[model samples]
Target: MSSPLVFIDGDQGTAGLQIHERLRGRTDLTLMTLPATERKDVRRRAEAINACDIAILCLPDRAAREAVGAIVNPAVRVIDASSAHRTQADWTYGFPEMTPGQAERIATARRVTNPGCYPTGAIGLLRPLLDAGLVPENHPVSIHAVSGYSGRGRAGVEEHEGPGAVGAPSFQVYGLELAHKHTPEIQRYAGLARRPIFVPAYGSFRQGIVLTVPLDVRMLAPHADAAALHACLARHYAAAAHVHVLPLHQPGDLKHLDPQALNGTDDMRLSVFSNMEQGHVLLSAVFDNLGKGAAGAAVQNLNLMLAQ
Candidate 1:
């Protein structure tokens, strides 16, 4: 039998380039590409997309949607690496670790929407607790996240890393309007009845992200404490391959967290730190925005599709 054919529609952009690199030399799938001259030609693009068993769209939201529309083959599966269809009911949200049997859904899905970078961390941290009833649906949740410059896509990369670029900032907060693109998806998947307040920022680095959520122990039902929160997350993700829950309260040896610690891999780490006496807890998630957040996720979905 022939190996499954995979085409990456926007293979030159940040997310596309990363997906191409990760899929390079893979044995299970045959990676296909178009020449630069024909990259923008709609006919050529559609042909490439239709010829594949699976097509991965790494373009902007509009372009990604266009690419999906261009596919005429009913058998061609799609993994869209954009926010275009995240909240759409017809498309499966592509975060395998989000729940059990999610991977199987992706494997059979005709359209899979890759999750947003910030939502990946936020949902990863909150979903388990919310499911366990540790965090109520209407809980007043607030998320603060810092991502490397790469999370901004092409313009951000050019501004920070390109020649003549005015690179670097100590720290800067965005989404002041409290209406971020990822908010809907976060609320939907995190099982929140009320939208959470999200504040995101881009640091000087190129990749990786850290998202923090603070909780008050006294507000939880039964007066659940910090350890309970940690235990809930730990138990939920215990069997997950890429998601790990770190133990809370390491005595005096507990160290400060670093955002860039897991830069190159597709793994995401979660930690909970709490002080019952102080009635406070801090839940955090660390991951590579371009990895588990985007490209790695697309590839993982591709693997699931082909495995079917």
Candidate 2:
């Protein structure tokens, strides 16, 4: 039999470009992309999508939805790298390490929705603790994350690096309205009963993310402390290939976390730090926003789907 055909629907955007790069030399599958002149041609886009065994969508929310609607082929499986279907019940979430057997679920799924970049880190940290019952579901949770400007896609690149880009601010915070698109994706998959306060920011760098969620010891289940939280995360990701839980840190072991530390790799490092005296704890996830956050994640999901 011929190798399976895989098509990338929007291979010129931030996430799509990275995914295309990662898959450029692969010999196992046939990679297809429309030329620039035809990328926006509706007939061509629909025909390309309908002809592939797997279609990876890296488009804006509306376009991604429209692409999905255009797939008339019953055998054309999809891995959507957009927020359009993340919370929808029909689309299987593509974060394979999120729970037990999740990878297998993706391998067998016909429609998989890639997790949002921010939600990938937030859900990665929150889900394990909530699953282990170390943290309460209804407890008020707040997430703070800083990602490279690439998280904004092409426009972000233009704002920071294009000609006449002399005065861009070094940092800026958005989502002051507490209604970021990733919030529901985080809450739903993280098993939270209450909505979370998600505060997101973009640094001037190209790509990577450091996402943190602070916790009060008093807010956790009885007998649950920093060590307990660390152990819970370690246990959840023990067998995970790409997620690593760093050894719990003592005072002065590490002073700071550089968001760009894990650039260019798909690995995610989860660290736990605490101050018992103050009854405070901090949980962090460090990874490349383009890697695990966007393109890398889409490829990871693509591999699982290919295996089946």
Candidate 3:
């Protein structure tokens, strides 16, 4: 008749710290963490993980995997906030609003993989269209996203805000090698047959993301058009609590979208903009990367896990 014990594996990192802050002072469960000296102790870390009712992993891909490998207790459910298990077959994806009954799946899942920040936006836009045959499976998709410097995680936070750091670039595009880690995640989850081009940039601001994917209406199916695309997205997220698709043909939609608009919350907004004369449609998603993208997502999954 006691509260559940929750452990955060890498509480020093940005995502972990944020998760801790969100869960702090809550009387529902006990938050557990290792001291700095014992943080790297393998056996101690394993003990902490296996002892918790839930373990939220906010470590790097490698460390996250290792932490998962060390869990011997079947009761210790996990919500990994890393790229390590996103594509894994056995782990349930932790985007509760992603699809129908996805929240129930997260509620019962023993191994839930928290989604990457970029894939959250891309998949949110593409999944419904692909499933409805609006967009072909083999469509060569291209995603361009601008996230605040915090998207880079702790390193980015340091580069932009650390005491030793100064004069951080105003904006910078990365993943020039065309091999970003989020590429496979986006392609796989978005159900695209061909590899998509993802160009992600970092702005000088702290949190939020603006991800845009453009489509050629002419290249789509016979009846597929901008309106149809918008309807598909709107229908998909109509009942969703955290993800909302803006109405089509808004008078001044451009004036409303700012990356930092949803900074403190865990909701995401998807908007479709098009020029009928030009045959080009741009789909964009705006949200707090650290919220819907990382920490808030983990906490949501944990809440689901505890509710059941």
Candidate 4:
């Protein structure tokens, strides 16, 4: 049998570059990328996309949509790494460890939408709680997170590390409009009845994410406490290979988190902190934004698709 031809539609951007880098050493399939000179040639791109067994889109929303529309081949399956199709009903969400059987669904899907980097962390923290009913759907929730500048893509890299680079800032925050593109994706996938106020920021580093969501245990089902919350998360993720729940914080122990802790791997860590007397708790997820949040996720989904 012939090796499957896999094409990357936006091989020059941040997510695209990482996906390419990770796949470079693979020997199982044939990889395809348009030459730099033809990257923007619509006819050539469309023809190349139609020729592959599967296409992984790492382009902006509009371009990803255009590429999807240009596919005339009946056999072409797609994995979109843009926010464009994430909320669309027809597309399978591409986070495998997210829910039971999600990986199987991705394997069988013809159209899969990669989760946003921020949502990968946020939803990873929220979904299980929502599903376990530890957090009510109507509960007003707020999320705060910081990712390395690579969240901004090529421009971010250029500003932080390019030849013309300005020194990376120690810290920065954005999405003040309260309408970040990842909000809806997070809300919908996390199963929240109301919209969440997501406060996202960037740090001087290049790639990693630490997302936090604060909740009031008083808002949970009657008699709920920190241990209940922790048990729920632990139960839900116990069998998951890549996602984990850390041991609860020790009494009067260290109270800090470093975003760069898991910078280079696809694994993720989830931790729960709470004050039982006050009915308050904090949930955290840490992972490589460029790894699990973007390229690593795309590659993981690609493997599922290929296995089927």
Instruction: Evaluate all candidate structures by whole-model CA lDDT and list the values in order.
Output: 0.88, 0.94, 0.92, 0.91
Over 239-258, each residue of candidate 3 has an lDDT whose tens digit, in order, gives 88889988886545466569
TM-score of 4: 0.97
Q: What is the lDDT, from 0 to 100, of the residue 223 in candidate 3?
A: 85
For candidate 2, what's the RMSD? 0.7
Best by TM-score: 2
lDDT of 1 by residue, 180-283 (tens): 99999999999999999999999888899999999987777674688788888888898988888887865455677788999889899999887666888889
Residue pair clashes in candidate 3: none
Instruction: Report backbone clashes per prediction.
Output: 0, 0, 0, 0
Candidate 2, residues 204-262: lDDT per residue as tens digits?
99899999999999989997899999999999999998999999999789999999999
lDDT of 4 by residue, 1-308 (tens): 98889999999999999999999889998999999899989999999999999999999999999999999998999999999999999999999988899989999999999999999988988888888887888989899999999999998989899886666677888999999999999999999999999999999998889999988887787755778778888988899877889988655574688888998888889998877777678899999999999999999999999998
Greater lDDT among 2 and 3 belongs to 2
The 10-residue segment with the lowest total lDDT in model 2: 160-169
Ranking by TM-score: 2, 4, 3, 1
Highest-lDDT candidate: 2
Query: Which runs of model 3 end up more than 4 angstroms from their true locations?
Result: 250-253
